[model samples]
Target chain A: MLEINNLHAKIEDKDILKGINLNVKAGEVHAIMGPNGSGKSTLASVIAGREDYEVSEGSILLNNEDLEELAPEERAHKGVFLSFQYPIEIPGVTVTNFIKTAINESRKANGLDELPAKEMLQKIREKAELLDIDRKFLSRSLNEGFSGGEKKRNEIFQMAMLEPKLSILDETDSGLDIDALKVVANGVNKLKSQDNAVVLITHYQRLLEYIVPDYVHVLHDGKIVKSGGKELALELEAKGYDWLK
Target chain B: MELKEKLVASFLAFENKVSVDTDSNVHDIRSNAFDHFEQHGFPSKKDEEWKYTSLKSILKHDYNVFPEGESAIEFATVKKYFLHEIDSYKIVFIDGVYSSFLSETSHDGYDICLLSAALKQPKYKTVVDHFFNTIAAKKSSITSLNTAFSKEGAYIHIPKSTVVPKPIQIIHFSTGNEAELLLQPRNLIVVGENSHVQIIERHQSLSGNVVLTNSVTEIFANKNSIIDYYKIQNDEKSASLIDNTYVQQKQHSHVSVNTFSFGGNLTRNNLEFFQEGEYIDSTLNGISIIGDKQLVDNHTLVMHKHPNCESHELYKGIYFDKSTGVFNGKVIVEKEAQKTNAFQQNNNILIDDGATINAKPQLEIFADDVKCSHGCTIGQLDSDALFYMRSRGIPKKEANGLLLYAFANDALEKIKIPELKTRITKLIAKKLGVDLGFDL
Candidate 1:
């Protein structure tokens, strides 16, 4: 479902991802684990087309379409989603309204009419139930004064709403407590289908216990130094990243 | 001749046109105000308060001091300017003349009428004489200019313990009767003890002609009274407005003034508040969204004179293209005003490289026990927030508009009327050049 060939990316003058390549097919989950400052988040950002990072060399293809020149929103319209580690707090924009706008904007980009209000509400209600979100919480401002767990859960709720083709979870489990991790993992697991893919970028192996990955890749410096399977996560957790370096 | 000299020379003709009794107190007040204007002319950039805003270009127009030939406008042409969804007491003026046909005044248990009638009639003379121009700055040159020509405007008076069911809408329209016109409107509102009132005022020009409005408003909130005043300055690019509003609050009174500036050539708002007794609450909020070569300046002041009084001020500006903005908020807590709590915040966003914002927050606190804080920020929109919204599938333009709307939302949250809030929200969305999909 996604392919990266020699993806050399840099932010300003500093090189982050140097000559890295990865591929993942539909119906599979991939985990990219690295220590602090190992370009794990940079890979996710580059895949999502964040403008701050420049892809100096090579290209990224999603479903055989080059995403080199696509903007973040264009990538989103093409069914790419990035769940941020620290969600932006937009006061005065209710979560439900934000989700509605996002869904409608995506629809509009695809030459479709806006979703009817009734259908939108039903979808929202269903998604809220799936994510265990309160109706009152949906009416509050988007992430304004939200707890860490609530923010991550809200991101998962949005991911469920959009149903994107490729979902990149960048450090989504960092600030979450055990209960929130379970809820977020459960939501992701239920939404997984044969036509979509999930990329989990994390610093620890705790999340893998809940949502097991089909493959595990340890990113060092910028390139992927090691590739293995689910048992590799437990091995790394036991030995720590110092042994990999 | 310079516009100042012409205005100075037109004072006698103005008085002659009004044909005021020479011995009346109103005549004396006008004469004294004219004298002050003649001495100071118009404020220059050399003055500390007028340092950032220049009036040289605006003051050069040969404005018609008094418009000739009465011009009547069809209500349909100007209906959108009013909050037409709800029933309101409207005091409308056209080219400095009271439009009785377009106005809906009242005298039942209260007075919601024109200032001219209150000045001439014997029944309202006492109320007019005591409160008119009492809180307005006597030494301000432009305010004095408005006072000198303050013959017609809105006059509202609520009796003690009376709550006005309907809001009062005071609208001023210019029909472009002259090549260049100058309008001075003076408003006096007195909310009696335990009374409440809400007012919405706007200055609009029908045609693309040069119009300069120098307006003055004085409001008195008696003991335990509440007042909410809204000023909507969304005139044409050829229109310029200088608004001077003064407010006086008695013990336990609450008063708030919200100024929304969306369009105009050059707009200056001078809003001040004076706390006369203890436990007074004052709020000053403003939002300015302008583009092109337009400029909006907001100068606000709050004086805490008695103990335990609280005041809050928040101003937000969104400038696009080559627009420029200025915000000067001053709060003073006197020594006798112990336990005073005052807060001020001014946030601005410059969308273009040519856009500019000058913000100054001045806090003078002589009371050591008081809590007075002020904050000011000027920058472009947060790129991180923008990227986040765009990543959610919203286009860049809509995301920018939404962020700007959210930045200005807190100030709009204080609108007491639902219809008015919706109208202002639509206005903001329109100003931001986005639909926002739904009412905020």
Candidate 2:
């Protein structure tokens, strides 16, 4: 469902993502393991259609629909979701209100009527239970004054509500404790289906044990140097990125 | 008297020729204010308050006293406005004159009347005289301008120890469309000892052309009484006006005023809060959104006359399309007013490069034991917050609108009236080009 051909991008005239290629079909989890400067986050940002990243070359397609020229929100409406490395603190915009807007915008793009408030609240209750997030957090401003783990869990809860076709978890486990990590991983794993895909972008191999990946690719210097099965991630966890380099 | 001759001949001739001429107070104080206005006329650019704005275009017009004509505020408009969100007493005014035909008040344990009629009452003359004596002294030419041309004013008196459940709603409308008109709408509210009441004063103009409105409001909160006044000035874009709000608080009394200046050409607001009693608390809040060449200037003063008084103020503004905005908030604590706590903040987001905001938060504290702070911030939209929302499925326009409304919520949320709250909500939505459904 996702394809990238020789994708090249830059920020401030410096190349970040040098000619790289990757493919992930539906019903699969891919783990892209890279060191600090291997363009792991840059790739995630470019795919999410962040305006600051300049795409110098190549085309990225979701189901063969051109994704580069679309605005960030338009891309998001097309079933693209990104869990930020650092969740933003959006003061005064309540979490429920934010989720409602997101869900309605996506529904409008799909030519569907927005769900009524009562129905939306009911759905939010179920999602919050599955994601292990307190209803109190949802009532406040979006991620305002929240702990790091709560922010990550809230992001996953949002993903569950929107039900995007492709989910990019960029450093979702970076700042989470082991307990919070398990809750977030459980929420993410519950969202897996036959027609959806998940790209787990993480530096540590511990998260891979919780949400096992079907394919593992060693990314170095903006290029995938090696490709293997789940065992490859375990191997790198033991030997580190030095082997790939 | 040559300048007076010019004013009476050219200006009063236009005032006499208006189609709808209402009764005006030709009293000594107003006549003296007019004499003072003849010397200063309108404030010039040399005046610190009028530095960013020029009333030259307004001065050039042969302005007359807009007379009281037929009102367009029928039952349908009131229902459309109040929305029955909360129970409220409605008082309507047209072209600076009271419209008793369209209004009804219970006078339930309260003193409420038109100043024109109240002046005739022997018992209420002392209060009227006190207000007339001190209002212009509370501010600058803006109050002087209002005092100079006040055609009509509203009065309300709540008895001691009573709490009015429903808020008193005042609607000031400029109905006639002859252009080059002037209106001075005045309001005087006195809450007796231990009484509490809320006041909502709304101003609007039916005509799209120019209307020069000089309005003044004097509020007196007696010992242990509380009065909350809100002013919504949605005048015509071409209208030039000066609005002055004066508040006097007694010992342990509470007073607060929130003014929303959303529409005006060259508008100025002067609010003065004098804490005359011990342990009194005062608050002044304002929000102004300006577009085009519109200018909205607000000057506020918080004076702690006695010890243990407190005052807090916050004003936010948004400017676009070369609009100019000014905010000057001053806090003064007397030498004996110990333990005085004063705070002031003024923030503005200039949406366009050409738009400018002159913000100053001043403090003059003579008390040795006092907590006084003031701050000002002028910047554009937060790009970080903008990108964060856009990263979600929210569109750019909707994102910007949400952020803008969030920036305004600090003041808008303070509005206690639900009907007025929702109306202002929809007004900001429309201004941001977003759809909130309940269109104003």
Candidate 3:
């Protein structure tokens, strides 16, 4: 469902993602394992179309359409979801409002009718129960003054709400504790489905035990250096990326 | 007369009768305000207050002042704009003229009358005339302009120790066909010793044409009394307004005033609070939501006249379009007013690039024991916050609208009146294109 060939990107004239290539099909989960300063985050950000970063060269195709031709919001509507590593704290904007706006925008883009509050509330409650998210979470400002773990859970909750076809979990395990990581992994597992895809980006292989990926691709210096089966993550866990370097 | 010429003529007309009793402690203030206005002469472009707002637009208007005539409003019409909701000793003024026949007031409960009529009433003559010219008497030109043509204004005297549950509502409806109008509305409110009262004065335009409202309200609070005053100015954007309110506080009295300005092309409000008695406290909180080329200038002065007085002032503005805002606040502590604790803060947010804000908070303390401070800030929507919302799949416009409304919540939270707060919140949402009725 997604294809990338020789993708190059830079932030503020500083090259981050050099030539990179990857391919993924429906019902597949690919893990990109990279050490620090390896352009792992930059790749996730570039694919999400963050304006601060520029694409120097390369092409990304999703559903056989040029992804570069779309705006960040357009990319989102195209089912390109980036679970932000560090979710932003928007003070004074409630979580319910933020999620509602996103849901409507996505529906509008997908040519579907907007869901009103009556049905929306019921859906949110059902999703919240499935994810074990508290109802009070809907009232607070969007990640404002939230704990690190709550933010990660909220990101997954948003993913659950959007029901994106392709979700990129960018370092979603970085700030989670063992318990929180379990909760996050459970949420991802519940959301997994065939005919869709999940790209799990991480530094440590510890997250692999909870939600195992179908393919493990070692991303070193902006390019995918190695690709293997799910056991490859456990192998990397046993022998860290430093040995690969 | 030419526009500038008429203003100069108006100020010229009031320059002579400006006087204060020498034995009274406030005589020097009277002299200062008189000399200030005399030299300034109705704030032309040369004055800072008149920089963005030009009175010349109204001066060139070749309209006659609406003479007092038959009132179009009934007691039921009066009930619409009333604040306290229930039975009020309602006072009505049409075209700045006191309507005697349409007004229903009773001395059995309190003292309410037209300032002109009270001047002739035997029992109320002393209290009525005591503050008539004392509030803004300093600007002989201003009082001269209003009083020289004083056809009508509300004069209230609350009896000692009487707590009025229902707020007295004063309604001014301008009804005339003239191309231009000039209204000199006035009010003299006296809260008797230890009494409590709330006064709401709502200004409306029936003509909805180019007009000018030059209004002044003078409030006097007796010892140990509390007075809550509210002013809502929603006039036609084409109209020009200049409202100057001078307030005096007695010993141990507390006075609070809230000004909500939503309309007018160029509106200037000068609110001066004097803490004359020991332990007196006063606070002035105001909010203005502006659009287009509207200019709202609020100049405030807090004077600590005696020892142990405390005052607090906060004035905020949310400016949209190419509108401009000016908030100049002064907190003055006299030498005798030792241990005075006064604070002032002015915060403004400009929604659009073309919008502008000018804020100056000043404090002059003559007493060493006084604690006085002031601060002002002009900030815009946070770019990082905006992008964060946008990244969540929210459209750029919808994201901006959310953040902008959040920027206004700080001011909306300060409105104490629940009904008014909800109304203002909805009004803000409607203006910012959050038509779904934002739940604040």
Best by lDDT: 1
CAPRI grade, predicted model 2 = medium
Tell me the spans in candidate 2 whose CA falls farther than 4 Å from its real position.
Answer: A116-118, A218-228, A231-245, B1-28, B66-73, B77-84, B366-368, B436-440
lDDT of 2 by residue, A1-245 (tens): 88999999999999888888989899999999889989999999899898888999998999899898898888888888999888887666688888888788778877999888799999999999999878888889888789899999999999999898999999999989999999999999999999999999999899998999999887888888898999998889889888667
CA shift of A158, model 3, Å: 3.5
User: Can you give the lDDT of residue B433 in candidate 3?
Assistant: 70
Using TM-score as the measure, which candidate wins? 1
Q: Candidate 1 chain A vs. true chain A: TM-score?
A: 0.99
Residues B143-234, candidate 2, lDDT per residue (tens digit)?
66566555467778788899988888887767655566677777778888999998887777776866877778888889999888888776
- Per-residue lDDT tens digits for candidate 1, residues A98-174, read 99999999999999999999999999999999999999999999999999999999999999999999999999999
The CAPRI category of model 1 is: high
TM-scores of the first chain across all predictions? Answer: 0.99, 0.98, 0.96
TM-score of each: 0.99, 0.91, 0.80
DockQ of each: 0.86, 0.50, 0.38
Of the pair 1 and 3, which is ahead by TM-score? 1
Each candidate's chain B TM-score? 0.98, 0.90, 0.85
| Best candidate (score: DockQ) | 1
Best-to-worst TM-score order = 1, 2, 3
